[model samples]
Target: MPKAILKLYLILKRERFDIVQYSTTNAVFYAATASWLACIPVRLYAQWGIRYVVFSGLVKIIFKQIERWCCRCSTVIEPDSMGNLEFSIREGLYPRDKGRVIWNGSACGINIERFDISQKDIWRTEYREKIGCDVHHLVVGFVGSIRADKGCNELIAACRSFFSNMPMARLLLIGDKVFYSTIDKDLRDWVESSDQVIHVPPNDQIPQYMACMDVFALPSYREGFGMVIIEAEAMGVSVVASNVPGPADAIRHEVTGLMVPVRDAVALAEALQVLLRDPAKRTAYGVAAAAFARDSFEQKKFLQYVLADKEQLIAEEEFQINHAGKHV
Candidate 1:
């Protein structure tokens, strides 16, 4: 670790970097420290998610402390979600003054061009048929890590309950399943045994799959920001997400999508059923959601916002450095 840090520090020193930024825990630790040691004026750390919150015992303690040190080394900590920024400040993991969220909360907003609503019908028909489902099937899609933290177990339980009512409802999970004990036993059994569940590996064709969804579900326990929620909306797919911080910002409850309490299987199931049963309401929500995404969440807007902030901060830092050097 020391050798890696020195190597990075030398690179920054040689390049005479005006700014340095890092995101992941490993990268943040190394990059932030190297940037700090190299006396870079703008040291930014992008907080994507809180890993320590998921662990326990010594592991949690170790990760939390490591994050704390990373925060200390950074001049600014930009969390993609306001909820995470609040938690980081509340826990003193990052200073309140240094933490900020750009726009509402998304690392990089969705590319609306990819999820072209003009070709929605074509993509929907194509992808649904490709996945062996037709217009008759009620598809509930989820696109994230198939792990405990993503609320996969809760989602599966909710779908199972919903299936008892609408047997035709299919759960299309479009991410790799993680082999961990944290995954529910019932979920495992159902996935292995039931034909209603379809597991697709992660691919570049996310927008295509997203267009076919009757509804999208994100029952995540934690998130820096639920960017997928916005992506689904861009595809004109209404969402039912956990009323957690990250997703809450992405959705307009009862308008763009429904928000269920975190880990509440019954609520999740009921919300899914409501949308599935009422095509009019679902279509209305989808229309409203797409407009919301189009108006608010474009990748270019996020890039502009962040780049403007970066420019301003870097200028301020350099001005201060020159001011101090004159005194020295």
Candidate 2:
């Protein structure tokens, strides 16, 4: 690790970088260490999420210490969500003043133009028919890795409950199941056995798949920020997400969509049932969610915020250099 840091420091020193940004835990530690050693003018650590939150024992302690060191070494810590920022501060991973959230809080916001509702009907027909599901059926969509921490078991349970009550309801699981080996065997068995459950491999046409759905579900145990929630919203789809930090930040309970307790299959099922049964309420929530997403999580607005931050940082660096020159 020391040798790697030394090599990185040499590169940074030679390059004379004005800004050094690191993402993920490993990159943050190594890059921040090198940047600090190289005396980079602007050191940034993007805290997308914390993986060690789910761990225990000495492992958790060691990871926490590493995160803290990275945070201390960086000039700025930008967490993708307010909830995550608060969590980091509470855990003493970083000081509150050093951190700031971008826009409403997503790594990159949704492209409202691409995920347009105008194409919803077209894509809905195309995908639904492909899956042999009629237009009247309520498709509860999920787009992400199929894994344990993502609440796949809870989602399957919720779907089972929902399907029992409403046979017209279908589950659309879209992602690379092959890569996510942590998926429960029961969930896999249910998907394979049930005709109503459609497990499509991950594809580029996420917007089309999202449009086919009347509602989206992301019952993740934890997230830095739930970008897909806003993406689904941008497509005029109501969401039922876990009441964890990331999803909570994106969803406004009862207004935009619904929020259930983390890993609570029964509560998730109830939320899905409510949306599926009440078409008027579902449409209202979807409309409000679309408006909220466009106003808050648009891609253009997100980029502007990021560019503005970079400009400010550059200005500060210039001011410091000028002051140092005057002092000399």
Candidate 3:
């Protein structure tokens, strides 16, 4: 680790880079250490989300200290969500004044033009048919990684409960089932047979899949920000998400979509039922959601935020050249 840090320091020193930007905490530590060692003028860290739950107490503390150290070395810290910014400030990870909020809290916004309602109908027909769903059946879809931390188990449980009551309802999961546990095997195998559950792998044409759902569900316990929610909304699909930090930021309850309690399968089931039973309400929500997403989470805004101050960064390079010339 020390040798790697020294190598990074030498590279940064040779390149004479300005405004070094680090994406994750581990990267932040390396950048901070390198910048301090090489006397680099500016450093910045992007705090996307908290990952303390994934690690133990001592490791969490160590990671927090690294975050603080990186923040101290950097000129700015870019937090993805309001919740994250506030948490960073509270935890002394970054100074309140230094942290800047990017629009909509997502890494990037969906391409609204490409994800049009006109392109959705064909996908809707095919996917519904594949799941044995008819016009009368309500289809709910989840488009992301099939991991336990993403509340996949909770979703499966909720769908199981819903299936017992409403056989006409279908839940389609569209993503890679990469992170399967021993406990998940029995339930997952059962879902494959009995329930109206379909496990599809990762595909390039995700927007097409988003088009097929009447409702999109993301009951994740933690997220930096849920990007698929925005995509689903752009494709005119209403969503049901957990009332946690990141999902709450993405979805406006009773407007664009519905939000339920974290880890509460019963609440999730009830929320799903609301959309399943009322086709009119679902349509209204989807329309409103697409509009809201278009207005608030535009791709142009994401580019503007991410590309802000680039000209200034370039100008700094010119200024440094002129100053060095004068001295020489």
Candidate 4:
């Protein structure tokens, strides 16, 4: 890895590159090491979150050391949110002064104007009719990958419990399965046999489906600022999510949506029941959620912060290069 990085750095250096931007932890480590070896001083690292470190064992400790080394080599380390910045500080991975937060969590959010509910009535009707989720059935939806870490299993359990009480409610699941074979047989049977549960394949029509649902649900065990939460909110769908870091940061409890503990199927079911029974409350939450997402997680604000951070990192790197040149 070191040798290949050094070779690539020599090639890029000869090409006269002005700024170096690195994404992901492994790439940042290699880029920082290669830049130091090649005497190219302009280096910047972008972090979504420390996933490997938080997920793995001894490797996580090593990742922390590697991150510290990369942080020292790079001119700046840009994190996606204040929540991530706090995590880095608590983990002792990077100095607080070295980290910068880009606005609105995601690097780029969904195009809000394109997902307007007014333009989606036909699609909504088609979705409703196709899934047998008419006006009589209150639909609760889930979007994103079907993984245990994403709490898809918990969602299924919650839906089973929710449907037992509110038989008229429907579960709308959107996204491709991450490991279809690994899922429990009983759970698969339940999803297929249950008339109330409808599984949609991953498609470009996410916005249309989101608009059709009364409430959007995701009870993830881990997330580094989920873009889907903002997407659902922008489509005027009320959300019910796990009380984890990213979801908690995105959702305002009872105002925009309800939040339950991670992996609490009963709590998720109860929350679903609340939205299912009360049509007026659901609409109120949907309107409030849409307004909140537009004001907070819009794409324009995110782009502005990312661009500014990039420029500032470049300028600092240039200053370091000039200072080193004077000493030589």
Candidate 5:
């Protein structure tokens, strides 16, 4: 850690950067420490999510201390979500006055043109046939890293329960099976063997895959911001997500989508079943979700907020320097 900090310090000093920003916990620690050492005029620590939420004991303490130190070293603390911003303040990780959230709270807001529903018909037919599912099949999709922390096990269980009632419903699991060796053997075998489940490797055609889904599910244990929820919504698909901080902020329960208790396979399955049975409700939610996403989570609006914040910070720094010079 010391060596990494020193290396970053040298790089910052050499570049003479006007502003230094770091994202993610690991990067925040090293970059903030280095930026402090180099006395960078503006040091930003972007808190994407908290990993220590899932950890405990001595390990959690160590990580928490590191996060606190990173916060101390930074000139500004920007969290991607309001939930996370509140969490950081409650935990005393950073001063509330020093923190700010960008727009509606996401790393980057949805690109409506990219995830637009206009191409749904074309992409749905192409992807559904490629994945061996008929057009009439009700597809439930999940896109992200397939691991325990992402609630893959619970998702599998939910699909098992959902399939018992809606046999024709299909589960389309996208993304590579990261940490596959660490996952339980039984669950791994089930995913491989189930004809009702189609596990596709990660691909760049996310917008197209999202267009093919009737409902999108993300039963994650933790998330800084569930960007995919908005992405799915932008593509005119209703969502069934865990009632966690990030997801809760993104999804308006029973309005844009349903939010079930985290790690509860039964609730997750029941939510899916409810949407599958009611085509009218699904269409209603999808339409509302798309409109909500466009109004609240547009990329242009988010960028404007962020760029304006940066300019304000820079102007404040210049004012301070000029005022100090006059006093001298």
Candidate 6:
């Protein structure tokens, strides 16, 4: 870790960058510290999500302190979601002044044109057939890591209970199980054995899978920002997400998607059933969701926002430099 920090510090010093941004646990901690030491004018720790929330006791304390240190070194603590910024400030993790959330709360936002494949009916049909889905199937899809934190277990249980009545219904789970997966044995076994569930190893063809889905679901326990929900929205897929910070911001309950209580399989099942049963409501939500994604969370707009922010910060930095020079 120290060597990596030193290497990053040297790179920052050599580059003399106006801004340096990093995310995740180790990268944020090391890179922020390095950027601070290198005296970069803008050291940004772009926190994607809070990992320490899942831990407890001394372990959680340790991780929180490490994150606090990382934030201290950073000029800005940029959380992707407003809820995350509020949580960090409320917890005293970072000075409220230093924290900010970018437009509409996503890591980078989604490309609407890329996910706007609703017109590609042929590919959608072929993809569904390849994934073992029949024309009769009512597919609900999830795209993310398969872990306890992601509420994969809850989704599995919910699908099993709910989809039993409709054998034609399918659960399409994308992404692979990580080495240290905290998800239930039921999820692990079901992924391999269950005829009702279809598992696709983690790949880049998410929009393709999204095209085949009737509904998208994200029942995460916690999230910095539910980027996947926005992606699904871009694909004109109605979602059922957990009523937590990240997903809450990504989805508007009853407007674009439904929000169920976190970790509650029954509520999750019931919510999914609503969309599955009511084709008209589902279509309405999907249409609204696509409009929302295109209007607010387009990738180009977000990139422009970030670029403008950097330009403003650079101008401020230059003014300070000039002011200091005149005084000297």
Write the number of the candidate with greater lDDT, choosing between 5 and 6: 5
Mark the regions of model 2 whose C-alpha exceeds 4 Å error after superposition: none
Clashes of 1: 0
Which model, 2 or 3, shows the larger lDDT?
2
How big is the positional error of residue 218 in model 1, measured in Å on the Cα after superposition? Answer: 0.9
For model 3, how does the per-residue alpha-carbon lDDT over 1-328 read when each residue is reduced to its tens digit? Answer: 5887889999999998866877765777887888877877666677666676445689977866776777788777776777677777887776788887777677676677777767888887886676667677777899888878788888988888768778777778888766866227767876778757777788887877777788999998777778788889988899999877677888889988899998898999899989988889899899998898888888887778678745555577679879999999
Query: Each candidate: RMSD to true structure?
Result: 1.7, 1.5, 3.2, 2.7, 1.4, 1.7
Which digits, one per residue and each the tens of the lDDT, describe model 5 over residues 87-153?
8899998878999888889998889889878898899899889999887899999999888888778
Per-residue accuracy of model 2 over 272-317 as CA lDDT, tens digit each: 8899899999999999999999999899989999999889989999
In candidate 1, stretches whose alpha carbon ends up further than 4 angstroms from where it belongs are: none
User: What TM-scores do the predictions have?
Assistant: 0.95, 0.96, 0.88, 0.87, 0.96, 0.94
The superposed Cα distance between candidate 5 and the true structure at residue 101, in angstroms, equals 0.5
lDDT of 5 at 284: 97
lDDT of 1 by residue, 1-328 (tens): 5998999999999998777889987888899889999988799888888778878999999999999999999998899988888888888896788999988679898888887888889999999998899989999999988888888888999888768678788999998766436788877898879888898998999999998899999989878789999999998999999987788889999999899998898999999999999999999999999999988888888789988989888889979989999999
Candidate 6 lDDT over 119-139, as tens digits, reads 646657888989988677899
lDDT of 3: 0.79
- Name the 10 consecutive residues with the lowest summed lDDT in model 1: 176-185
lDDT of 3 at 95: 71
Candidate 5 wrong stretches, greater than 4 Å: none
Residue lDDT tens for model 4, 261-319? 98888898888888888889988998898898888877867677768877876788778
| Stronger candidate by lDDT (2 vs 6) | 2
**Distance (Å) between predicted and true CA of 102, model 1?**
1.7
